[model samples]
Target: MNALSIDIEVNEAHLRQQFEDCSDIVFRSFKLSDGAMLLLVYLDGLTHVQSVEDNILRPLLFNGLPQGEKPVPSLAERMKREWLPLANVQTVDSSDALVQHILRGSLGLLVNGEAAALIAQIPGFEERSIQEPKKEATLRGSKEGFVENLRTNTSLLRRRIIHEDLKMESFTIGSYTQTEVVLAYVKGLADENVLSEVRKKLGQIDMKGIIDSAYLEEWLEGSSYSIFSQIQNTERPDIVAASLLEGKVTLIANGSPFALILPITFWSGLQSADDYFERFVFVILTRAVRYAMTFISFALPAIYVALSTFHPEMVPANLMISIATARENSPFPTVIEVFIMMFIFDALQEAGVHLPNQLGPVGSIIGALVIGQAAVEAGIISTPIIIVISLTGIAAFTIPRYSATMPFRLTRYMILFITGFLGFVGFAYGIIFLLIHLVMLESFGTPFFRPVAPFDGRRIKDIFIRYPFWIKNGRNKKGGQQ
Candidate 1:
């Protein structure tokens, strides 16, 4: 009794009634010669009206059947003989085929006394053009990004790879939303273990709707609460193609502008789109600056906290008394003051992101001038703390991937908390904990801390420094070889 039951006796009228609210469904009746009755229903966006008319309707109406002929054999023979490559029609006894056909962008044909309907699988979608990337925009690289279409996106992949081995498999997920998801990879390039793992993870995501590629990333990635993004999400088709070449599998969702690239590590997040476009020396210097900024974003406040209470000897003699005098009238501890300022800084950043473009500049001006100037003038905070907070905010923006910067933003607090309680020793403990946690993480079966934890000198050449293109040796247009 626990098993699910199907209501087979439910007529087309009942099924139509159940799905009447769905605006995309179009049900049309086709009464052929020889008293043959047929019902057709298809989705508006998915199926083309022209294919329905030419291949299916016109043919079935003119050359459907003879007056005294049996239905099954005649219909089956016509389908087998007449429809060349395009029209793929199948016979269905129960309502399952009709349901599936309608869901899969096919026109369903139901006939009287035939015990079945002819399900014609014809999917023709009008997809939009690829967009320009938003977050990862590059002045020197290709500007074209991905759009909210799977076929168009796949075609973009095809344009990039152009190899016979580049393969794509399609599936529809989400019971109600019916989102189209594609699994794409170069066949011979991708490792079988990782490919199988990708398929397995995708298979397990049973949900109501997939609004974007980010949704799929959250559902299919290894951890639920991990701060880092295990599945690399990119908006550019070139990035997708590049990742595919490197032996990574990409999951492209129907309504998502971003595609998911697996086996991404910390170094991948640090890399920008312009790295390959610019000269290697520029790339190396910019990368070093970004790394320095990352450290400053995380360590500046903690250093201030440590110096204020525990490590006063570290500060210059002239600067120590000014800082001490600034805090004399303040009620909060140094760590508390640092935490409050950091929280306000993050709030301003969030507000700037959410507000209209016109209002954002005003928010920045008010935050920078009114808050910092007024707070210092009012003697509530030291001028030095204001400078430190400003520097930290600027440093965070240097990181190319916004998500990669999140770990540092979070770890800053750990540093502050530890520096407050146990001074330098506690700060060291926090760093060890972070490094160990990063080591424990895996990005699609690849080490999250790649080339560092394993100590590969060849990989390290490109890690901290970007060598010249000739010195770059090989581009792993296939994923792991590089």
Candidate 2:
């Protein structure tokens, strides 16, 4: 039952029973001029019908075997070597393998009096065309983005990093889906330990299916409880090629357009795709602005709450008087007002994301302006709090990665609550704890706050400022080997 039988009827019956009730499974049988009965099995939409008809059916039915040729031991072997016009053809001995091949858009040919089956690769599935990345756009760089097709994505990487050392290892992770996942890296350049760890983690995944690269990210991350993403994902193949050159590993799944990059650092989130494409002088200024805005986003509201409520003397006399005058008519405390405004801001943002593209931006902007003005005019919220919340929202938008912004958003609320209660002391302690947590985190054994927490003076330059390519001599020292 496991292996194909020499009798065509036995093999046909076994395969039919295996694929019973499968409406899309095609079973086409025909006899050769020499009277050798052949059966072709494949999925309906997945297999290329034209290629099968022209190259397989037409050749086998009309051409037959070579005239006066000696009898070969296996009919499948002869067809694969001379009869078939296809390039990718292989033999499978077991019925299980034959079924798997057929499912994966391959044509399975079983001949009379032969135990072996020939599998022809001719996959034809609809997929999105490669377009510019929607999220990680840059002013200047390659515009091509990744599509859902696995082979097409790999080809994109190969086109960029054309070297023999660029190696890819394939894995089938999903139990039912049997989705393909590829791990790519530069040989000898990537750290052996990191590679081993990636392999071990991937093998341990017990999921029923992996629909996207994000699924692998959860399994690959060393710290599952942490909010910070250990693995970076992007739709741009250029970014993937850049990561591979730096001695990092990438995971590209079959159905997902996003590719996962590993051993990422805190700096990775702050860095943008435009950083490398633009001039270093411009990049340095942009990066500085981003870092500054990142801090403002995380601590602006907390600092305001701490000073206004608990440390009034620390604030200037004029600002304190102005804050008090603005808040005179508000019913809630400063902390409570901030919490309410923050909640509304977050809800509006979520609404924007879920809404259609035509209305998302317009609705969020109009909603925020209208809601904030209405609250302030109605004396429900103070004017100063509105300004602070608006500034904080803008600052948070400066961070390039959407994933990176989430942790800051969540922690901002926590710090705001703590600062409201304990003032400056609480704000300081919150920052210290966040830094400690970041230092403790790792991505596939690479320190999360690399070159900063450990204080690598040499590598620190790339974090605070973009170094020109001329001065760089070797691969990235953070996670890759020299």
Q: Which candidate tops TM-score?
A: 2
What is the Cα-based lDDT of residue 109 in candidate 2?
Answer: 88
Could you give candidate 2's per-residue lDDT for residues 1-482 as a string of tens digits?
Answer: 39888999999999999999999999999988889898999999999898889877887778885443666677656765674566588898899999988998888988888889988888876779999998888889999999999999999999999899999999999888899999999998899999999899888999899988889988888888997888998999999999999899999999999999988998899899899999999988899899999999989999999989998999889989999999999999999999999999999989999999999999999999999999999999999999999999999999998888999999999999889889999999999999999999988888899999788987887888888765554456564534
Name the 10 consecutive residues with the lowest summed lDDT in model 2.
473-482
Q: Which stretches of candidate 2 lie over 4 Å from their true place?
A: 65-70, 83-85, 474-482
Model number with the top lDDT: 2
**Across residues 1-482, which tens digit of lDDT does each residue of candidate 1 receive?**
11111322334675587467998888777677776776667888889889888877887789774323445454445564556376776766556546766877877665554555566778877776666787788878788888887777888889888899998988778887888899998988888888898788788889998888888888877866777778888888898898888788889999888888887887888888888889887888899998888889999998888888889998998799988887787777888888888998988888887889899868976987788888777777777788889999999999887767887888898788988998878888888888898888887778888889867887788889988655666655444345
Off by over 4 Å in 1: 1-11, 17-24, 30-35, 45-94, 112-128, 325-329, 474-482
TM-score list, all predictions: 0.85, 0.95
In model 1, the clashing pairs are: 245-477, 245-478, 245-479, 246-478, 246-479, 247-479
